[model samples]
Target: MKHVLVTGGAGFIGSHLADELLAQGYRVRVLDTLAAQVHGDGTRRPAYLHPNVELQVGDVCDKEAVVRALQGIDAVFHFAAAVGVGQSMYEIAHYTRTNNLGTAVLLEALIASPVAKLVVASSMSLYGEGLYRDGSGGVHGNCERTLAQLERDEWELRGADGGLLTPLPTPETKAPALASIYALGKYDQERMALITGRAYRMPTVALRFFNAYGPRQALSNPYTGLLAIFASRLLNDSPPRIFEDGLQQRDFVSVYDVVRCCRLALESPAADGEVFNVGSGQPLTVRDIALRLAQVMGKPHIEPEITQKYRVGDIRHCYADITKARKRLGFEPRVKLDDGMAELAAWLKDQAAVDRVAQASAELSARGLTV
Candidate 1:
């Protein structure tokens, strides 16, 4: 059995990926720092993590830890990064150190101890505004909302002719428009891995994941995905607060589907040196997702509070065009949104989340990141 090393394997997506890898008969070892933001104030392994998987508690930025984790590992999945688009904006140095410098440390270690395969976890955030199409069907990948437009409460992308542009399925071909510090870090990580992998003759693949949510999400962390944030609010008997009229569109993919794609990338030669967008290939309005989650959690009475506010790096719409992943990696998202949300709701019943949305929002507003 080939041995694999998954960085940040104790976290939501990484832990699920570990379970999948272990079930497939691969010896899986995880290297993670167990950040307090995700795992609370403890250093012990997460109970949700598979007991059979070997866990190495360490930061990805630590050279010694990375080198130690690389021992006896045939392949590597670089999933370690500071997640949170909003948090990354104010905590610039923290995000840069963890996501960018950490990847550099990992890459240097990999250069000394080359792995057969390297799969880097990237994010769809890099694509600031997703592909848009004018009324005449002309595609616009460079469309962006100006501050003047945002100040006027104009949410949707507009063409030069002042016509409303429709959001299209964003493919890998769309040039990245890094909008936030978090996005810039993710882009740096992916590009760094690909460049290092190519130079060192290590087969590498980058998976630009959309909004991934499921069982192991950090619900208490307001900086997490939208679904988890909504769940946290409902769990606390508060209405889910949404920004910018709640019409912004996003693609939510199941963690199961994402890990399956990870495994496919690890095993498929065709995925080497390529970047694929991993998502459900379905778009749902933010308002729709809030209502669906509330219904699933048996809290339909708690309506979502639509705040006419906006975050600095917030995108109007961006969903994946999984044609590349489907055609290349044989990846197809199997979990429907309803089923996935139900499963998440079931898990949330037994979970306790501290309501930090208000605090996070206040911080952003204080920093003028929100309006």
Candidate 2:
């Protein structure tokens, strides 16, 4: 059996990725610090509690821990990091150390280890504002292409007079520039991984994920992604909070789909040293997303409350050009935004069971299920 290591395997995306790896007949190993901030109440534990999973509780920044966990591993899926734009903006130093330097540590360890394949998780925040400028970066033409592709989606262009303007979808080539410390850090992480992989002649794939969401997300975590936050609030009859005008758009992809692409990146030789946009290629406004959640849950019309407080460096519109991912990795997002919303709603409704599983995993972890 193939032995694979996933860093940050207890967090939302990382945990789900572990599940996918196991299902595909890979013997999975998870390395995580089980940080209190990530686990909240110290209840959520190592993701690989099952017999097939080998769990290691250690910091990725530690060479000893990383090297030990990487032993006998054939591939590495590095999903460990301080994620989110607003949170990273506030915790700049922490983000840099964990995301940037931590990746460097992993790469260094991998260079000495036998692992041959690596898949790095990245974000769309790297593309500075897709502005159309004269040989220089400007906001005009760059944004025009994005607005064009998302034309059929929720965010339609309105003339100054509130008249309808042409709309378009954001493509992979024109990634919105990083507006926050977290985004900049993640962008740097990808660059470092690519450069280092080239030096080592290691097969590496970087996936620029766009708003991935699903079940294992921590509802109590304030920095949780928007989709999970909405699902959690709606399940409890709490009004979902909106930061902006609720008009800003984002391309929300399902966690299942995101994991699918990660596995593809590992298995496909063509994905090595390449970056692919993993998303639904469909843009949905924040308002539409909230409403969709409500509809999915079959709840009374409870709209999210609009808050004037907007995080600095937050973009007004963002989506993806999934064409490259589809053509190269043979990846096609199976779940639509609506379908994903419904699935998330179902999971949110059953938090009691989810909590049990989390507790069980934590218990097992405390008993040496993890090192």
Instruction: Name the best candidate (by TM-score).
Output: 1
**Model 2 lDDT tens row, 1-371:** 28899998877888888888899899888998877655755655544345566778889999999999988889999988987665665577899999998999999998888468888998877664322323232234344213332333333333334444432445556644666788888888888888888988988888988888888886655556777667667766767777546887778889999999999989989998998888888878888888878888887578887754344456666678788988999999998776777778787776621113234224433543221
- In angstroms, the error of model 1 at 18 is 0.4
Model 1 agreement with the true structure over 7-123: per-residue lDDT tens digits = 999999999999999899999999999999998988988999999889999999889999999998899999999999999999999999999999999999999999899999999
Q: After superposition, how far is residue 260 of candidate 2 from its true place, in Å?
A: 0.8
Model 1, position 218, has a per-residue lDDT of 91
Best by lDDT: 1
Per-prediction count of colliding residue pairs? 0, 17
Q: What C-alpha RMSD separates each model from the true structure?
A: 0.8, 8.7
lDDT of 2 at 188: 84
| TM-scores for all predictions | 0.99, 0.83
In model 2, what lDDT does residue 334 have? 94
CA lDDT of each prediction against the hidden true structure = 0.94, 0.74
CA shift of 39, model 2, Å: 1.8
